[model samples]
Target chain A: MPAKQTLTFPYSRRPALGRRRFLQGSAAVVAGLAAANCRQNLAGPPAGSGGSDGTLHIYTWANYTDDSLAAAFTELTGIPVVVDIFDSNEVMLTRLQAGGGDAYSIIYPSDYMVSEMIDLDLLTELDQSRITGLDNLKAQWQNPAYDPNNAHSVPFCWGTTGLLFNREATPGAPADWDFLWENQDELSRRITMLDDMRETLGATLKSLGYSYNSSDPEEIQAAYNRLLELRPHIAAFKTTGFENELLGGDLSVSMAYSSDAIALTLEDDRMEYIIPASGASLWTDTLAIPATAPNVDAAYQWINFMLDPEIASAAVERLFFATANQAAFDQLPADIQNNEDLYPSEAVLANSEGIVAVDTASTDLFDQLWTKVTSA
Target chain B: MTPAPSPPRPWADRFATRRWLGPVVLLGPAGVWLLLLLVLPTLLILEISLVPGLRLGQPSGGYGLGNYLQILQPVYLRVIGRSLAFAVGSTVLCLLMGFPVAYWLALMSPQRWRNLLLVGFILPLWTSSLLRAYAWAAILRPSGVLNTMLTTLGLPAQNWLNTPTAVFIGLTYSFLPYMVLILYASLEKLDTRLLEAAADLGATPSQGFWQVTVPQTLPGIAAGCLLVFISTLGDFVVPTLLGGASSMNISRLIYNQFLGPTRAWGFGSALSMVLILAVSLAIALLLRYGDKSSVSET
Candidate 1:
């Protein structure tokens, strides 16, 4: 019989090649691309893109930027600007903290996040001498409590969080937080609170006749208990997921930020938003340069560009967000000025408070209570 | 029957001394891989579990059992329990649906079409899992594809998305193919002569199936169950999207603890350890039972 042979042992070495080597090489290439992409994002605007100094990158909310505004800025100042949108203050803060946002010359952080960022030393103090049109802002925002004297941040936009509901779904528009509590029986599985802890918990605190920035542990616990009481009726704790349901008529009410509610109300007549009778958290999103910002000159220019009344007014009309620039507000169309959602009545304004970061003890208490509420 | 003829002397001489090297060479890379990615990360999580209240970017104070103790809190326990319920429910659901299809594919399907049917079953897995979850959302929502179809069929519309039932459905749908694939692999090797012999011995069709076919496929069933169970237990997406308000499973809680307002890395690490332990126990049970079933089948 002819000798029969079988391949055996170490498979003859065969140059030790495998498909995995190709995968490793491909992975290295992908990782290199990702790092370069991240670097471009973190190192400031791309080369030769803006005003001969490169485009200014402004990290902001989705509704804050419009194409025409960017196009106009490019035509006027020659400094092309790019906007990156984030859904929440915390997510933006996380990106900044993780060194992912060093490229941005400007970032929009809400009032309390501004305070937190300042404490963390992430923001650069503005050179007031170079900044133009500082006096064009609304009086309240001129020296806001969150960034007093405007030392670190410029109040770019201001709005209040409130209840947005489908008026056709229920008999009347939701007027207050207590309406949810009183009608928990009827509203079971039909409502959603913001996924945000501070906004949701703070609203609950305000509903129970407490301050939005209450530092008292007892008040925090009371708010926790109140939220627990309402959890059975709550369909979900969501920030952006409620939009589809609310628009589809499956959700009757959702706690929403004013910018989002205003846009939605404009889309449908049946949808309306109201500041609760007891009050809600008013938020001011501010533009500030990070300390690690690579292009300080570009940051200043971006700020001055936003402060321009024509630009700000056009943004307000296109974006549907209320602006902190008083000069711009004056230029807005009469219909926009009269829009109640953008500018609520004084009685509603009186009850609103800007969210502020409480002391560590209170924050801890809030965390504990949030856990219990969600777990239950 | 005569034992299979031994290999010729020259071939036997070559392999007899080198058989050990074959397994070692073939398995070394994967073993190293398992150690680095799986075993090392698990150990790191175990170490982190010992530190209490350890937030990321903060200096670690010391090592203790405080983080593990926190898991005993009623709130956290409820989350863990809910996770188990979802995983177990989905595993059973997948098994119930997967087994019959695997049986038909392996034992009954035409030989030429068998591979094609399997490719079809596996095609859904090629797309991103996130896209699948979103597709389920569109289909399961109140005014969604499923409800629209139901209304057209004169059936009542179902509101299943963002509910526990939705979570179960999503998980079962996501993992059913893996169960079927594993069972089919085991079942294709089944001996048909034994089944025919049982039937010839005056055994009824039902008895022949139970006594012959089932015993032959026990190993496949065990393997399929374990694969489905382990995958469902570690899943993070379905429970987050489909599990509406208050579906605070251990995985989501751990995520929130790290990334959300709390930023308690210690508690998150502790929860990670618990999840790792639960998955390990399931794997251990599978190895034992699955090995026994395979041996009995042989």
Candidate 2:
């Protein structure tokens, strides 16, 4: 008899979050487009009128904030912190652009988004003199490609994208991205890919021995065709909802971010995470102050609070984020320090690539191809 | 009175001409509201729909039919077709399931219990539709409650979740209460005297139901169906949550264009316009048929 389990995941309790994220994002964009003439008004007063309010308003990912973290900061400094969460980088950017996010003093953007925000002049340049623990970041992030010398953003957590599977249910260990296509029959209607267009399409590109950010039209077309072959066997394209299904044996496998997948692995022993042999995308979540921030001092204080080794280690233990700070890594337990999924070996590091914004033509091509894939 | 009429009252006489002020004051707030929030925004969407390849934060190009023409693509056309199928299928299902329950309650059920039963039917609507859709997900999954019961009964388990079947079930469940409410209103006013008169003339129950009952309630049917169809057509929640992969409907498609990794506002606006046009057409049908049926009944 098959073991039956309840379909309950922590995030599933708040099902409206996902739907609301999409709605608000789409609504903001529509409103923005309609009022394009008022774009200049959204720039949010000149940047120089920065003063510390009693509360520090932060805009970050959903799982990053907890009561204890905020309490710790408030205890250390007199300033209270009010946290708001966003589900995706695109949603955050859209909200910010629409001037709905002017109240936020700090924001958490991923690696690629840092560069995009820089291009859009949405970020404020960091003053090195104010921050204390810049030297604690791992060497890889010290002069990262997205923001050289940590000029505008501070690395908070870094991880890679990979496949999370139920070890007992899957036929065999998925050593690479090709495992999905190879076992499509046995895994029929029991697998889910990321809802993200870039991540899903990039995995296919890697499976075909091409770059994750391939701009070549022929290569892109080839990758699109390969994905179409596996589309029918796939159950859904979802970012967060797949966890409960996978846990209850309804889904055998899912593509997930390391932070989310790690939380589940800690809960259920049967789950396993593996980076594909060919390649996967490396991502880093960073803390930065938006240019329109009203409290620059509080924003710097929050970043420094996050960078402190003790606070970073505590966050890692409680939240399961892989910290980018070297000193924080030393403070972790041996088992966590040795966890390959969190800190993979150099060979695995060499195989991964960071996603970047492509040219306009390529972007349009990608949008067109993605529409075809989903519609088909 | 002729003497009091005095000299010719000017055309600008305050009290005589000011009679129009009462209506203007009454309708002013709603008229301004409709213009600012509804008409202006729709006009804005129409303007954006005319610009091709328009991305937010980027300079827009000259107006053209390029964005509208993109909808002619087979991929988008397929999405539109699937949306129509979901709407029409759920409307028919709601009519089938809701009519009998409504008829029993409106005409045959105990009068004291009528309100309670109707409230019970509508209780699900009080919760968030998002939560209801999630509940359906749990019930319809492979190892869910429905499949477990089926297996215990020695019946074949149906794999209905994440398929078009799930979409239909969810849509029908969401809109059935509205269908019942409208039909009950129409059926409550049902003339029982006509049925008695027909029976005395030797007309059978089935004949009376077909000839008298249906024609009298035809307007209600049209109104109920139009409401369900329009709501289902624009429903992004059910299809996004339950329809799973390969279930690309027009609302989700429009969402994707606007916020799903690609910011194609122009294309998204065009899709929105198409959706608006489809709904307008449904309302047109409702006005033409629904009014005529009621008029004939009167």
Candidate 3:
């Protein structure tokens, strides 16, 4: 969900901002290439001018903001905003951890990363009293798994990790995660999983009747071995770059986020996004202020700006992500509300697990196995 | 690098007494820039490499060789081995393909069109390397332009994208121009008289090329190969874009450590040091052989 941005061109297109920028070995250099286009979009006064000088710097996924969104916020608040995009939550977190994120007054991290930031004390505690429209949030987001009671982060966009396949290209419609393994011969070198480690590994874990956040070494090892079997058949691990191939029927299937997949299916009739019958990982990208945020006042204003139901609904209409704000959802057109992929049913939601920060040992295990899997 | 001797003047003679002053005045800005940007950052990475199990956003601990030692693990060794293989393979491919075109452009082709031909050869470099790799991706995918063309010609289609074969093609394509430019520079100065001299001495064309042409251009060949080797060795775009899952070389490995799921800065720094060392080793060889070959020829 953190990587829901279509603008990510993968260099797997820009880390989808970290890949080609590693020469410096510092997180600062990992600024997404999207910043080149984003620079011109920055409006009003110079950023980091301090003291509510009508400047707000936001670091977020590319899908979240458009020029109009920035213009709208500035029109209402009179604060010109600068938007910088990050492809992955890890890249976002790394930049902040490396002290390169002080300029950003606001950042959008995915659900699991919200919890991670909270644990690290990197995020400021949200001021519930100052924020209006807090009650408009859906019941689930009110006390979400990643950030309990929405204490530190605001739920912005939500989606699930699932297979997006070409109906004509695949031998059969994939009903679940196990479909790929079962149909390896037909799907060989034609399937692209997410470049994301957790989503792919977690999906595999769920297929084997294990939790998406399985921490047990044995369960993880089993998942690794299973992934190894499917790896040869896997064409590439990509988040943003597979769209053209999949649409062209060169790729049979791709593991993708609902936001990206939903957009594709809307344009191309051949593409279909499905949640695995076994289960899938549910992800929520959120808005949070870094503890070291320079402009607290403008940050609050921006959060409140997004919280407004009218603004929120408009974002959903244009951006195509499911609205977390119930007021916004109620205001959305009937067609959008009825879109099953955008808003999946309750039973499907119940089966899905939110990824969490696993213990260090488990993380190390995942990294080791992932390295070996890719290398071998 | 030698500084020019200044015209002796009354005011300048005082400062000129300090002989080291001339070099400092000449190299001061660039030297300071290199020290700050390159040398210092590399040393910092070196220091971080010595700290075992150092994760980002964590406090530093006592340093050890654990990170470097961890790189000795077979999994990492295979990655290093893969990177080396890609580098060596690309260098050879470039040399094989570049030498001929360079020979023609430098010596055999129409003299007036030589510069234009060289420009045309290097035109691909003007576009972003990322864009070039992406273009290759578009061309090499299963149903991409390459296969389309092959099928049109009544040839078997190839699905080289996302394979090691694709990586080699992409790397060779990206680096070939550099090889050509350097080889051309060397081949341009090929004293035709030497070839004539060899021919007059009962050497066949092949013998003349092997004995005189190659030896004369040995320095450029070494320099170009080293340049290609270094560039391909550190390349992140081609391998990541075209190499697919198996192309986890040292650069990608370092990328994964720093920006990937694991923020193992320590291990990433270790990998960086190793890559740096490998490139430095290439440069060292270039210095050793690039100069020595020219010297031996002269």
Give the best candidate by DockQ.
2
Q: In order, what DockQ does each candidate have?
A: 0.13, 0.34, 0.32
Q: In candidate 3, what are the lDDT values of residues A257-330, reduced to their tens digit?
A: 99878877886677899988898889899989988788888999999999999999998888788878999999
Q: What's the distance in Å from true for residue B289, model 1? A: 4.5
Cα lDDT tens digits for candidate 1, B1-298: 9899976798778787689788889999999988886788678778878988675445778999998888898888888888888888988998899988988999899999998999999999999676688678767776676776677689997878778889999999999988888778777788988888888888998998788888877867887787788888777777767776757787778766655666676787798888878988988888877734443443
Model 1: per-residue Cα lDDT at residue B203: 92
Residue A314 miss distance in model 1 (angstroms):
1.6
* Candidate 3 colliding pairs: A9-A13, A10-A13, A11-A14, A14-A17, A15-A18
Residues B1-298 of candidate 2: C-alpha lDDT, one tens digit per residue: 3556567767758766678887789999999988886788789889999999987667888899998999999888988999999999999999999999989999999999998998998899899787788789889888887887788789998878889899999999999998888888889889989988889999999999998899888888998899899999988878877888968899888877765677687898899899999999998998877634432342
Quality of candidate 3 docking, DockQ? 0.32
Clashing pairs in 1: A42-A103, A50-A54, A50-A55
Docking category of candidate 1: incorrect
The Cα error of candidate 1 at residue A300, in Å, is 2.8
- Ten residues in a row with the worst lDDT in model 1 chain B? B289-298
Candidate 1 versus the native: TM-score? 0.83
Residue range B1-298, candidate 3, lDDT tens digits: 8999977697667766667688888899999988886888788889989998787666767899988888899988999999999999999999999999999999989989888999999999899887788788888887777776677689997878889899999999999988898888888778999999999999999999999999989888998898899999998888888988867888888877776776788888999999989999988998887734432332
C-alpha root-mean-square deviation, each candidate = 13.7, 5.0, 7.0
B227: Cα error in model 1, Å: 2.2
TM-score of chain A of 2: 0.87
| lDDT tens per residue, model 2, A1-376 | 1465343432354344344544543444333333332333334333333354457888787668788999999999988888766656876776677664566789999998899899888999999999999999999899999998989999999999999998877999999999999999999988999878889999999999999899999999999999999999888888766777787678899998988888778777888999999999999999999987877889999999999999999998887889999999999999889988888888987788999878888888888898889888
Question: What's the DockQ of model 2?
Answer: 0.34
- List runs of model 2 lying over 4 Å from the truth: A5-53, B1-20, B291-298
Q: What is the docking quality class of candidate 2?
A: acceptable
